[model samples]
Target: MNVTSGQEWVRGQFPRLDWLPDETLFSLCSRQHLVMGNLDPATTSTAVLGLSEKFIKHDIPCGIAALEQNGFHYWGSAESILLHHTIFSVFVPFQNKIKIEDAIITIKGDRIDSLKYRLGLVSSGFGAEHPLKACPYCMREDVDAHGIAYWHLTHQYPGVLICPRHQAWLMVSTKSRRWSGRFEWSLPTKDCLIQQASSQKLWLRPAFLNLANNVIDLAVIGRVMSLESCTVAATYRKAVLQGGRSASLLDRIEPLRRFHLFESLPEDEKSTESFMNQLIRTPRRSI
Candidate 1:
Protein backbone atom coordinates (compact mmCIF):
# COMPACT_ATOMS: atom_id res chain seq x y z
CA MET A 1 0.00 0.00 0.00
CA ASN A 2 0.99 3.65 -0.38
CA VAL A 3 2.51 5.58 2.55
CA THR A 4 -0.66 7.56 3.22
CA SER A 5 -2.85 4.50 3.10
CA GLY A 6 -0.56 2.62 5.47
CA GLN A 7 -0.40 5.55 7.90
CA GLU A 8 -4.19 5.74 7.92
CA TRP A 9 -4.45 2.07 8.82
CA VAL A 10 -1.85 2.54 11.57
CA ARG A 11 -3.64 5.60 12.96
CA GLY A 12 -6.87 3.61 13.11
CA GLN A 13 -5.12 0.95 15.19
CA PHE A 14 -3.35 3.43 17.50
CA PRO A 15 -4.94 6.79 18.16
CA ARG A 16 -1.60 8.13 19.40
CA LEU A 17 -0.19 7.57 15.91
CA ASP A 18 -1.20 11.16 15.17
CA TRP A 19 1.79 12.42 17.11
CA LEU A 20 5.05 13.38 15.27
CA PRO A 21 6.56 10.46 13.35
CA ASP A 22 8.83 8.15 15.36
CA GLU A 23 11.99 6.14 14.57
CA THR A 24 10.18 2.84 15.01
CA LEU A 25 7.84 3.65 12.15
CA PHE A 26 10.78 4.89 10.11
CA SER A 27 12.60 1.62 10.63
CA LEU A 28 9.53 -0.44 9.85
CA CYS A 29 8.54 1.58 6.79
CA SER A 30 12.14 2.08 5.55
CA ARG A 31 10.86 5.20 3.82
CA GLN A 32 12.99 8.36 3.93
CA HIS A 33 10.20 10.86 4.54
CA LEU A 34 6.52 10.32 5.32
CA VAL A 35 3.72 12.86 4.76
CA MET A 36 1.16 12.80 7.54
CA GLY A 37 -2.39 14.15 6.88
CA ASN A 38 -3.29 16.01 3.69
CA LEU A 39 -2.46 19.69 3.16
CA ASP A 40 -4.77 20.36 0.22
CA PRO A 41 -8.61 20.67 0.36
CA ALA A 42 -8.87 18.12 -2.48
CA THR A 43 -7.10 15.40 -0.38
CA THR A 44 -8.28 16.49 3.10
CA SER A 45 -9.18 13.61 5.42
CA THR A 46 -9.31 13.15 9.23
CA ALA A 47 -7.19 10.02 8.99
CA VAL A 48 -3.42 10.44 8.86
CA LEU A 49 -1.48 9.09 5.89
CA GLY A 50 2.25 8.39 5.42
CA LEU A 51 3.63 9.33 2.03
CA SER A 52 7.07 8.22 0.81
CA GLU A 53 9.13 11.01 -0.67
CA LYS A 54 12.30 10.82 -2.79
CA PHE A 55 14.65 12.66 -0.37
CA ILE A 56 14.02 12.16 3.38
CA LYS A 57 17.29 13.62 4.64
CA HIS A 58 18.46 12.81 8.17
CA ASP A 59 21.73 13.29 10.15
CA ILE A 60 23.27 9.84 10.69
CA PRO A 61 26.13 10.01 13.26
CA CYS A 62 24.17 11.81 15.99
CA GLY A 63 21.13 9.53 15.63
CA ILE A 64 23.04 6.24 15.86
CA ALA A 65 25.13 7.40 18.86
CA ALA A 66 21.95 8.35 20.69
CA LEU A 67 20.47 4.90 20.07
CA GLU A 68 23.67 3.13 21.22
CA GLN A 69 23.77 5.16 24.42
CA ASN A 70 20.28 3.88 25.20
CA GLY A 71 21.21 0.20 24.47
CA PHE A 72 19.58 -0.33 21.10
CA HIS A 73 21.46 -2.47 18.58
CA TYR A 74 21.11 -2.65 14.81
CA TRP A 75 19.49 -5.96 13.94
CA GLY A 76 19.07 -6.05 10.16
CA SER A 77 16.94 -4.72 7.30
CA ALA A 78 15.22 -6.26 4.31
CA GLU A 79 13.79 -5.01 1.01
CA SER A 80 10.15 -5.67 0.29
CA ILE A 81 9.09 -7.86 -2.62
CA LEU A 82 8.02 -4.77 -4.55
CA LEU A 83 10.67 -2.56 -6.11
CA HIS A 84 11.98 0.40 -4.02
CA HIS A 85 10.54 -1.00 -0.80
CA THR A 86 12.83 -1.69 2.17
CA ILE A 87 12.27 -2.30 5.90
CA PHE A 88 14.85 -1.82 8.66
CA SER A 89 14.45 -3.31 12.12
CA VAL A 90 16.42 -2.77 15.34
CA PHE A 91 16.27 -4.33 18.81
CA VAL A 92 15.75 -1.64 21.44
CA PRO A 93 14.73 -2.00 25.05
CA PHE A 94 11.22 -0.80 25.76
CA GLN A 95 12.11 0.93 29.03
CA ASN A 96 14.76 3.22 27.57
CA LYS A 97 13.83 6.58 25.96
CA ILE A 98 15.11 8.23 22.78
CA LYS A 99 14.60 11.55 20.95
CA ILE A 100 14.15 12.47 17.29
CA GLU A 101 17.19 14.69 16.63
CA ASP A 102 19.66 11.95 17.69
CA ALA A 103 21.49 11.17 14.43
CA ILE A 104 24.45 9.02 13.49
CA ILE A 105 26.11 8.77 10.09
CA THR A 106 27.18 5.40 8.67
CA ILE A 107 28.34 4.99 5.07
CA LYS A 108 27.70 1.74 3.22
CA GLY A 109 28.68 2.32 -0.39
CA ASP A 110 26.64 5.51 -1.08
CA ARG A 111 23.60 4.70 1.15
CA ILE A 112 23.29 6.15 4.67
CA ASP A 113 21.43 4.63 7.64
CA SER A 114 20.12 7.29 10.01
CA LEU A 115 18.87 6.93 13.56
CA LYS A 116 15.39 8.27 14.26
CA TYR A 117 13.12 8.08 17.33
CA ARG A 118 12.78 5.10 19.65
CA LEU A 119 9.86 2.64 19.90
CA GLY A 120 8.54 -0.30 21.98
CA LEU A 121 6.15 -0.76 24.91
CA VAL A 122 7.46 -0.01 28.42
CA SER A 123 8.92 -3.17 30.01
CA SER A 124 9.47 -1.71 33.48
CA GLY A 125 7.30 -4.20 35.34
CA PHE A 126 7.75 -7.04 32.88
CA GLY A 127 10.43 -9.27 34.49
CA ALA A 128 10.11 -7.62 37.90
CA GLU A 129 6.71 -9.11 38.71
CA HIS A 130 7.68 -12.68 37.95
CA PRO A 131 9.51 -14.88 40.49
CA LEU A 132 13.11 -15.56 39.44
CA LYS A 133 14.34 -19.10 39.31
CA ALA A 134 17.68 -19.79 41.04
CA CYS A 135 20.60 -20.63 38.81
CA PRO A 136 22.57 -23.81 39.51
CA TYR A 137 25.63 -21.94 40.83
CA CYS A 138 25.16 -18.62 42.69
CA MET A 139 21.56 -19.60 43.47
CA ARG A 140 20.15 -16.47 41.84
CA GLU A 141 17.89 -15.63 38.93
CA ASP A 142 19.30 -15.83 35.40
CA VAL A 143 19.38 -12.52 33.56
CA ASP A 144 19.80 -11.15 30.04
CA ALA A 145 23.41 -11.08 28.85
CA HIS A 146 24.07 -8.66 25.95
CA GLY A 147 20.26 -8.49 25.28
CA ILE A 148 19.15 -12.11 25.63
CA ALA A 149 18.34 -13.74 28.98
CA TYR A 150 20.80 -16.51 29.82
CA TRP A 151 19.58 -19.90 31.09
CA HIS A 152 22.71 -21.42 32.65
CA LEU A 153 23.16 -21.43 36.44
CA THR A 154 26.43 -19.52 36.31
CA HIS A 155 28.05 -16.78 34.25
CA GLN A 156 31.14 -18.93 33.80
CA TYR A 157 29.35 -20.71 30.98
CA PRO A 158 29.82 -18.78 27.75
CA GLY A 159 26.18 -18.45 26.61
CA VAL A 160 23.46 -20.77 27.86
CA LEU A 161 23.69 -23.68 30.32
CA ILE A 162 27.09 -24.81 31.61
CA CYS A 163 29.38 -25.13 28.62
CA PRO A 164 29.22 -28.67 27.30
CA ARG A 165 32.83 -28.29 26.15
CA HIS A 166 34.60 -26.98 29.26
CA GLN A 167 34.83 -27.93 32.94
CA ALA A 168 34.49 -24.38 34.21
CA TRP A 169 32.68 -23.42 37.40
CA LEU A 170 30.15 -20.61 36.81
CA MET A 171 28.57 -18.53 39.53
CA VAL A 172 25.99 -15.74 39.62
CA SER A 173 25.12 -13.64 42.64
CA THR A 174 21.66 -12.45 43.63
CA LYS A 175 23.10 -9.48 45.50
CA SER A 176 25.51 -8.44 42.74
CA ARG A 177 24.88 -6.96 39.29
CA ARG A 178 27.58 -8.95 37.48
CA TRP A 179 26.11 -11.55 35.12
CA SER A 180 28.53 -14.45 35.76
CA GLY A 181 31.72 -15.48 37.61
CA ARG A 182 34.09 -18.25 36.63
CA PHE A 183 36.31 -20.76 38.51
CA GLU A 184 38.56 -23.64 37.47
CA TRP A 185 37.73 -27.31 37.84
CA SER A 186 40.17 -30.16 37.24
CA LEU A 187 37.84 -33.02 36.43
CA PRO A 188 34.22 -31.94 36.63
CA THR A 189 32.04 -35.01 37.14
CA LYS A 190 29.05 -36.06 39.26
CA ASP A 191 31.12 -37.23 42.22
CA CYS A 192 33.20 -34.02 42.24
CA LEU A 193 30.21 -32.24 43.76
CA ILE A 194 30.97 -33.47 47.28
CA GLN A 195 34.75 -32.96 46.92
CA GLN A 196 34.25 -29.40 45.77
CA ALA A 197 31.95 -28.74 48.71
CA SER A 198 34.40 -30.07 51.28
CA SER A 199 37.44 -28.43 49.73
CA GLN A 200 35.57 -25.13 49.54
CA LYS A 201 35.86 -24.77 53.32
CA LEU A 202 39.63 -25.13 53.04
CA TRP A 203 40.07 -22.73 50.10
CA LEU A 204 37.37 -20.00 49.95
CA ARG A 205 37.88 -16.57 51.50
CA PRO A 206 35.84 -15.68 54.56
CA ALA A 207 33.83 -13.05 52.69
CA PHE A 208 32.81 -15.46 49.93
CA LEU A 209 32.14 -18.23 52.45
CA ASN A 210 29.83 -15.88 54.31
CA LEU A 211 28.17 -15.18 50.99
CA ALA A 212 27.71 -18.89 50.46
CA ASN A 213 26.16 -19.25 53.89
CA ASN A 214 23.65 -16.57 53.05
CA VAL A 215 22.75 -18.36 49.80
CA ILE A 216 22.25 -21.62 51.68
CA ASP A 217 19.87 -19.89 54.05
CA LEU A 218 17.90 -18.48 51.15
CA ALA A 219 17.65 -21.84 49.43
CA VAL A 220 16.36 -23.54 52.57
CA ILE A 221 13.83 -20.80 53.34
CA GLY A 222 12.64 -20.59 49.73
CA ARG A 223 12.14 -24.39 49.63
CA VAL A 224 13.15 -24.46 45.96
CA MET A 225 15.53 -27.40 45.66
CA SER A 226 17.59 -28.15 42.58
CA LEU A 227 21.21 -28.42 41.53
CA GLU A 228 21.66 -24.98 43.13
CA SER A 229 21.46 -26.66 46.53
CA CYS A 230 24.62 -28.62 45.81
CA THR A 231 26.14 -26.47 43.09
CA VAL A 232 26.19 -23.25 45.08
CA ALA A 233 28.18 -24.89 47.82
CA ALA A 234 30.45 -26.52 45.27
CA THR A 235 31.13 -23.16 43.58
CA TYR A 236 32.11 -21.49 46.83
CA ARG A 237 34.43 -24.35 47.69
CA LYS A 238 35.98 -24.40 44.25
CA ALA A 239 36.55 -20.65 44.40
CA VAL A 240 38.33 -20.94 47.73
CA LEU A 241 40.46 -23.94 46.78
CA GLN A 242 41.64 -22.50 43.48
CA GLY A 243 42.00 -19.02 44.93
CA GLY A 244 45.10 -20.35 46.82
CA ARG A 245 46.84 -18.32 49.55
CA SER A 246 44.65 -15.26 49.08
CA ALA A 247 41.60 -17.35 49.90
CA SER A 248 43.26 -19.29 52.73
CA LEU A 249 44.35 -16.09 54.45
CA LEU A 250 40.77 -14.85 54.47
CA ASP A 251 39.51 -18.11 55.96
CA ARG A 252 42.15 -18.00 58.72
CA ILE A 253 41.38 -14.43 59.70
CA GLU A 254 37.63 -14.89 59.73
CA PRO A 255 36.52 -18.23 61.09
CA LEU A 256 32.80 -18.86 60.61
CA ARG A 257 30.65 -19.27 63.72
CA ARG A 258 28.63 -22.46 63.81
CA PHE A 259 25.09 -22.18 62.58
CA HIS A 260 22.41 -24.57 63.84
CA LEU A 261 21.07 -24.91 60.27
CA PHE A 262 22.31 -28.44 59.60
CA GLU A 263 21.71 -31.08 62.32
CA SER A 264 24.97 -33.05 62.01
CA LEU A 265 28.29 -31.45 60.99
CA PRO A 266 30.23 -34.70 61.36
CA GLU A 267 27.97 -36.66 59.06
CA ASP A 268 27.78 -33.82 56.58
CA GLU A 269 31.55 -33.40 56.63
CA LYS A 270 32.17 -37.09 56.12
CA SER A 271 29.71 -37.39 53.23
CA THR A 272 31.19 -34.36 51.46
CA GLU A 273 34.78 -35.55 52.08
CA SER A 274 34.01 -39.03 50.77
CA PHE A 275 32.47 -37.63 47.64
CA MET A 276 35.49 -35.43 47.02
CA ASN A 277 37.86 -38.32 47.64
CA GLN A 278 36.18 -40.37 44.92
CA LEU A 279 36.43 -37.50 42.45
CA ILE A 280 40.15 -37.07 43.10
CA ARG A 281 40.71 -40.82 42.67
CA THR A 282 39.05 -40.85 39.25
CA PRO A 283 41.29 -40.16 36.24
CA ARG A 284 39.27 -38.39 33.57
CA ARG A 285 38.80 -34.85 32.31
CA SER A 286 36.06 -35.39 29.75
CA ILE A 287 33.98 -32.30 29.06
Candidate 2:
Protein backbone atom coordinates (compact mmCIF):
# COMPACT_ATOMS: atom_id res chain seq x y z
CA MET A 1 0.00 0.00 0.00
CA ASN A 2 2.81 2.37 -0.75
CA VAL A 3 1.58 5.87 -1.59
CA THR A 4 3.01 7.06 -4.89
CA SER A 5 4.94 10.34 -4.70
CA GLY A 6 5.76 13.13 -7.21
CA GLN A 7 2.97 12.10 -9.59
CA GLU A 8 2.82 15.48 -11.35
CA TRP A 9 2.25 13.74 -14.67
CA VAL A 10 -1.27 12.71 -13.59
CA ARG A 11 -2.08 15.90 -11.69
CA GLY A 12 -4.56 17.54 -14.07
CA GLN A 13 -6.93 16.63 -16.87
CA PHE A 14 -5.17 13.45 -17.96
CA PRO A 15 -6.35 13.21 -21.53
CA ARG A 16 -4.55 9.89 -21.87
CA LEU A 17 -6.85 8.30 -19.33
CA ASP A 18 -9.83 7.65 -21.52
CA TRP A 19 -12.84 6.80 -19.39
CA LEU A 20 -14.92 4.53 -21.61
CA PRO A 21 -18.71 4.49 -21.50
CA ASP A 22 -20.09 2.08 -18.85
CA GLU A 23 -16.55 1.27 -17.73
CA THR A 24 -16.09 0.32 -14.09
CA LEU A 25 -13.92 2.62 -11.96
CA PHE A 26 -11.64 -0.37 -11.40
CA SER A 27 -11.24 -0.62 -15.16
CA LEU A 28 -10.39 3.09 -15.33
CA CYS A 29 -7.59 2.59 -12.82
CA SER A 30 -6.47 -0.57 -14.61
CA ARG A 31 -6.40 1.26 -17.93
CA GLN A 32 -4.48 4.09 -16.34
CA HIS A 33 -1.97 1.53 -15.12
CA LEU A 34 -1.38 0.36 -18.68
CA VAL A 35 -1.33 3.88 -20.08
CA MET A 36 1.13 5.18 -17.48
CA GLY A 37 3.22 1.98 -17.48
CA ASN A 38 2.86 1.60 -13.72
CA LEU A 39 5.03 -1.26 -12.43
CA ASP A 40 2.23 -2.75 -10.32
CA PRO A 41 -1.44 -2.46 -9.36
CA ALA A 42 -0.54 -0.74 -6.08
CA THR A 43 1.25 2.07 -7.90
CA THR A 44 -1.74 2.63 -10.20
CA SER A 45 -4.15 2.61 -7.27
CA THR A 46 -2.01 5.17 -5.46
CA ALA A 47 -1.91 7.42 -8.51
CA VAL A 48 -5.64 7.14 -9.28
CA LEU A 49 -7.27 7.14 -5.83
CA GLY A 50 -4.39 7.77 -3.42
CA LEU A 51 -5.44 4.52 -1.76
CA SER A 52 -4.40 0.88 -1.72
CA GLU A 53 -5.24 -1.54 -4.50
CA LYS A 54 -6.03 -4.01 -1.73
CA PHE A 55 -9.34 -2.17 -1.45
CA ILE A 56 -9.94 -1.99 -5.19
CA LYS A 57 -13.51 -3.03 -5.97
CA HIS A 58 -15.22 -3.66 -9.28
CA ASP A 59 -18.99 -3.90 -8.76
CA ILE A 60 -19.58 -1.07 -6.27
CA PRO A 61 -16.29 0.76 -5.96
CA CYS A 62 -15.20 2.86 -2.99
CA GLY A 63 -12.83 5.88 -3.03
CA ILE A 64 -14.92 7.62 -5.64
CA ALA A 65 -14.37 11.03 -4.10
CA ALA A 66 -10.65 10.31 -4.11
CA LEU A 67 -10.76 9.46 -7.81
CA GLU A 68 -12.70 12.62 -8.57
CA GLN A 69 -10.24 14.71 -6.59
CA ASN A 70 -7.15 13.04 -8.06
CA GLY A 71 -7.12 14.85 -11.40
CA PHE A 72 -10.01 12.77 -12.80
CA HIS A 73 -12.56 15.56 -12.62
CA TYR A 74 -13.21 15.12 -16.32
CA TRP A 75 -14.98 11.87 -15.36
CA GLY A 76 -17.33 14.03 -13.26
CA SER A 77 -18.24 14.19 -9.57
CA ALA A 78 -18.59 11.31 -7.14
CA GLU A 79 -22.35 11.25 -7.57
CA SER A 80 -22.07 11.05 -11.33
CA ILE A 81 -19.45 8.31 -11.05
CA LEU A 82 -21.73 6.27 -8.80
CA LEU A 83 -24.63 6.63 -11.21
CA HIS A 84 -22.83 6.09 -14.48
CA HIS A 85 -19.76 3.93 -13.82
CA THR A 86 -20.73 1.78 -10.82
CA ILE A 87 -23.54 -0.70 -10.17
CA PHE A 88 -25.22 1.76 -7.77
CA SER A 89 -28.00 2.56 -10.21
CA VAL A 90 -29.28 -1.04 -10.26
CA PHE A 91 -30.04 -0.87 -6.53
CA VAL A 92 -31.65 2.56 -6.65
CA PRO A 93 -35.22 1.37 -7.28
CA PHE A 94 -35.02 -1.40 -4.67
CA GLN A 95 -33.36 0.43 -1.76
CA ASN A 96 -34.68 3.35 0.30
CA LYS A 97 -33.30 6.88 0.19
CA ILE A 98 -31.51 6.77 3.54
CA LYS A 99 -29.75 3.52 2.66
CA ILE A 100 -28.81 4.92 -0.73
CA GLU A 101 -27.34 8.04 0.85
CA ASP A 102 -25.44 5.93 3.35
CA ALA A 103 -24.02 3.80 0.51
CA ILE A 104 -22.86 6.91 -1.30
CA ILE A 105 -21.19 8.29 1.81
CA THR A 106 -19.61 4.93 2.59
CA ILE A 107 -18.36 4.52 -0.97
CA LYS A 108 -16.76 7.94 -0.80
CA GLY A 109 -15.21 7.28 2.62
CA ASP A 110 -13.77 3.78 1.93
CA ARG A 111 -16.03 1.51 3.99
CA ILE A 112 -16.19 -1.40 1.55
CA ASP A 113 -17.43 -3.99 4.06
CA SER A 114 -19.91 -1.64 5.73
CA LEU A 115 -21.45 -0.66 2.41
CA LYS A 116 -22.80 -4.20 1.89
CA TYR A 117 -24.54 -4.32 5.27
CA ARG A 118 -25.81 -0.76 4.86
CA LEU A 119 -27.50 -1.70 1.58
CA GLY A 120 -29.14 -4.87 3.02
CA LEU A 121 -26.97 -6.94 0.70
CA VAL A 122 -25.81 -9.11 3.60
CA SER A 123 -29.17 -10.92 3.46
CA SER A 124 -30.12 -10.16 -0.13
CA GLY A 125 -28.90 -13.64 -1.23
CA PHE A 126 -26.95 -12.14 -4.11
CA GLY A 127 -23.70 -10.44 -5.20
CA ALA A 128 -20.70 -11.93 -3.38
CA GLU A 129 -20.84 -15.31 -5.13
CA HIS A 130 -21.34 -14.02 -8.65
CA PRO A 131 -18.32 -13.75 -10.93
CA LEU A 132 -17.35 -10.74 -12.99
CA LYS A 133 -18.74 -11.37 -16.48
CA ALA A 134 -18.14 -9.94 -19.95
CA CYS A 135 -19.60 -10.38 -23.38
CA PRO A 136 -16.87 -11.69 -25.68
CA TYR A 137 -18.19 -9.68 -28.59
CA CYS A 138 -18.05 -6.51 -26.53
CA MET A 139 -14.50 -7.30 -25.50
CA ARG A 140 -13.37 -7.86 -29.08
CA GLU A 141 -15.14 -4.71 -30.25
CA ASP A 142 -13.68 -2.71 -27.37
CA VAL A 143 -10.19 -3.84 -28.32
CA ASP A 144 -10.74 -2.90 -31.94
CA ALA A 145 -12.16 0.50 -31.01
CA HIS A 146 -10.17 1.54 -27.94
CA GLY A 147 -7.15 -0.76 -28.35
CA ILE A 148 -7.89 -2.38 -24.97
CA ALA A 149 -10.46 -4.61 -23.33
CA TYR A 150 -12.20 -3.26 -20.24
CA TRP A 151 -14.84 -4.37 -17.79
CA HIS A 152 -18.42 -3.27 -18.24
CA LEU A 153 -20.56 -2.53 -15.18
CA THR A 154 -23.71 -4.06 -16.69
CA HIS A 155 -22.24 -7.54 -17.22
CA GLN A 156 -20.77 -7.72 -13.71
CA TYR A 157 -23.77 -8.69 -11.58
CA PRO A 158 -25.81 -11.58 -10.25
CA GLY A 159 -28.32 -13.08 -12.73
CA VAL A 160 -27.08 -10.88 -15.55
CA LEU A 161 -26.23 -13.72 -17.93
CA ILE A 162 -26.94 -11.98 -21.21
CA CYS A 163 -25.53 -8.89 -22.87
CA PRO A 164 -28.19 -6.26 -23.48
CA ARG A 165 -26.74 -4.74 -26.62
CA HIS A 166 -25.50 -7.81 -28.39
CA GLN A 167 -28.10 -10.22 -27.02
CA ALA A 168 -25.18 -12.58 -26.54
CA TRP A 169 -24.22 -14.71 -23.57
CA LEU A 170 -21.73 -13.26 -21.06
CA MET A 171 -18.74 -15.33 -20.03
CA VAL A 172 -17.75 -15.44 -16.39
CA SER A 173 -14.20 -14.40 -15.58
CA THR A 174 -11.87 -17.05 -14.13
CA LYS A 175 -10.04 -14.40 -12.11
CA SER A 176 -13.06 -13.42 -10.05
CA ARG A 177 -13.62 -13.37 -6.29
CA ARG A 178 -12.95 -17.10 -6.06
CA TRP A 179 -9.39 -16.53 -7.23
CA SER A 180 -6.53 -15.74 -4.82
CA GLY A 181 -5.61 -12.50 -6.55
CA ARG A 182 -9.19 -11.23 -6.91
CA PHE A 183 -8.35 -7.68 -5.85
CA GLU A 184 -5.67 -7.33 -8.50
CA TRP A 185 -6.48 -5.44 -11.66
CA SER A 186 -8.12 -7.65 -14.33
CA LEU A 187 -9.81 -6.87 -17.60
CA PRO A 188 -12.06 -8.95 -19.86
CA THR A 189 -9.86 -11.11 -22.05
CA LYS A 190 -9.96 -14.59 -23.57
CA ASP A 191 -7.34 -15.93 -21.20
CA CYS A 192 -9.54 -15.20 -18.17
CA LEU A 193 -12.84 -16.46 -19.57
CA ILE A 194 -14.27 -19.34 -17.53
CA GLN A 195 -16.05 -21.67 -19.90
CA GLN A 196 -16.77 -24.43 -17.39
CA ALA A 197 -19.09 -22.50 -15.07
CA SER A 198 -22.52 -24.13 -14.64
CA SER A 199 -24.35 -21.06 -15.88
CA GLN A 200 -22.25 -21.06 -19.02
CA LYS A 201 -24.83 -23.34 -20.65
CA LEU A 202 -27.86 -21.57 -19.23
CA TRP A 203 -28.15 -19.29 -22.23
CA LEU A 204 -30.18 -22.00 -23.95
CA ARG A 205 -32.96 -21.71 -21.38
CA PRO A 206 -35.80 -19.34 -22.20
CA ALA A 207 -36.57 -18.64 -18.54
CA PHE A 208 -32.98 -17.56 -17.92
CA LEU A 209 -33.01 -15.41 -21.01
CA ASN A 210 -36.27 -13.87 -19.79
CA LEU A 211 -34.79 -13.24 -16.38
CA ALA A 212 -31.75 -11.62 -17.96
CA ASN A 213 -33.94 -9.33 -20.04
CA ASN A 214 -35.96 -8.32 -17.00
CA VAL A 215 -32.77 -7.70 -15.02
CA ILE A 216 -31.39 -5.50 -17.78
CA ASP A 217 -34.69 -3.62 -18.03
CA LEU A 218 -34.74 -2.99 -14.29
CA ALA A 219 -31.15 -1.79 -14.43
CA VAL A 220 -32.02 0.70 -17.14
CA ILE A 221 -35.17 1.89 -15.38
CA GLY A 222 -33.50 2.11 -12.00
CA ARG A 223 -31.09 4.70 -13.36
CA VAL A 224 -33.88 7.25 -13.75
CA MET A 225 -36.69 6.15 -11.42
CA SER A 226 -37.06 4.93 -7.86
CA LEU A 227 -39.74 2.27 -7.97
CA GLU A 228 -41.78 1.57 -4.86
CA SER A 229 -41.70 -1.97 -3.51
CA CYS A 230 -45.37 -1.91 -2.57
CA THR A 231 -46.35 -0.82 -6.06
CA VAL A 232 -44.22 -3.47 -7.71
CA ALA A 233 -45.49 -6.18 -5.36
CA ALA A 234 -49.07 -5.16 -5.98
CA THR A 235 -48.60 -5.27 -9.73
CA TYR A 236 -47.06 -8.73 -9.56
CA ARG A 237 -49.83 -9.94 -7.33
CA LYS A 238 -52.46 -8.63 -9.73
CA ALA A 239 -50.85 -10.53 -12.60
CA VAL A 240 -50.68 -13.73 -10.58
CA LEU A 241 -54.29 -13.41 -9.47
CA GLN A 242 -55.57 -12.88 -12.99
CA GLY A 243 -58.13 -15.37 -14.49
CA GLY A 244 -59.97 -15.69 -11.12
CA ARG A 245 -57.56 -18.29 -9.82
CA SER A 246 -56.21 -18.48 -6.28
CA ALA A 247 -52.53 -17.61 -5.91
CA SER A 248 -52.02 -21.01 -4.24
CA LEU A 249 -52.37 -22.54 -7.70
CA LEU A 250 -49.10 -20.85 -8.60
CA ASP A 251 -47.18 -23.71 -6.98
CA ARG A 252 -48.97 -26.31 -9.09
CA ILE A 253 -48.02 -24.63 -12.34
CA GLU A 254 -44.62 -25.88 -13.41
CA PRO A 255 -42.93 -22.66 -14.46
CA LEU A 256 -40.13 -24.34 -16.36
CA ARG A 257 -42.48 -26.60 -18.27
CA ARG A 258 -45.07 -23.90 -18.87
CA PHE A 259 -42.46 -21.58 -20.31
CA HIS A 260 -40.45 -24.54 -21.64
CA LEU A 261 -37.45 -23.42 -19.57
CA PHE A 262 -34.69 -24.85 -17.38
CA GLU A 263 -33.61 -28.48 -17.66
CA SER A 264 -33.66 -29.12 -13.93
CA LEU A 265 -35.14 -27.54 -10.83
CA PRO A 266 -33.67 -27.62 -7.36
CA GLU A 267 -35.71 -29.82 -5.05
CA ASP A 268 -35.96 -27.11 -2.40
CA GLU A 269 -36.93 -24.26 -4.72
CA LYS A 270 -39.54 -22.67 -2.52
CA SER A 271 -38.42 -19.09 -2.53
CA THR A 272 -40.30 -17.94 -5.61
CA GLU A 273 -43.36 -20.02 -4.73
CA SER A 274 -43.45 -18.63 -1.21
CA PHE A 275 -42.90 -15.08 -2.38
CA MET A 276 -45.71 -15.18 -4.90
CA ASN A 277 -48.07 -16.79 -2.38
CA GLN A 278 -47.27 -14.20 0.23
CA LEU A 279 -47.55 -11.39 -2.27
CA ILE A 280 -50.99 -12.52 -3.38
CA ARG A 281 -52.20 -13.11 0.18
CA THR A 282 -51.06 -9.76 1.52
CA PRO A 283 -53.50 -6.88 1.18
CA ARG A 284 -52.48 -4.16 -1.24
CA ARG A 285 -51.07 -1.04 0.38
CA SER A 286 -51.05 2.52 -0.86
CA ILE A 287 -47.74 3.58 -2.34
Per-model RMSD to reference: 22.4, 4.9
TM-score, predicted candidate 2 vs. hidden true structure? 0.81
lDDT of 1 at 279: 35
Error of 2 at 264 (Å): 14
lDDT tens digits, residue span 167-205, model 2:
777787777665656366777889878653454453344
Task: Supply the global lDDT for candidate 1.
Answer: 0.26
Q: Which lDDT tens digits does candidate 1 get at residues 1-287?
A: 99977765654453221111112222222211123333442221111111112212211111222222222223222111010111111111111222211211221112233222221211321111111112233222212222212222111211111222232233322312223222111111222232223233443344433444444343333222222223444665575577552334433323321222221222344454554444334333320
Instruction: Tell me how far the alpha carbon of residue 247 in candidate 2 is from the true structure, in angstroms, after superposition.
Output: 8.7
Per-residue error (Å), model 2, residue 12:
5.0
Query: Residue 46 in model 2: shift from native, Å?
Result: 1.6
Candidate 1 segments whose C-alpha is farther than 4 A from its true place: 1-71, 74-209, 212-270
Candidate 1's TM-score reads 0.17
* Best candidate, lDDT: 2
Candidate 2: global Cα-lDDT? 0.69
After TM-score superposition, the amount by which residue 166's alpha carbon in candidate 2 deviates from its true location, in angstroms, is 3.2
TM-score of each: 0.17, 0.81
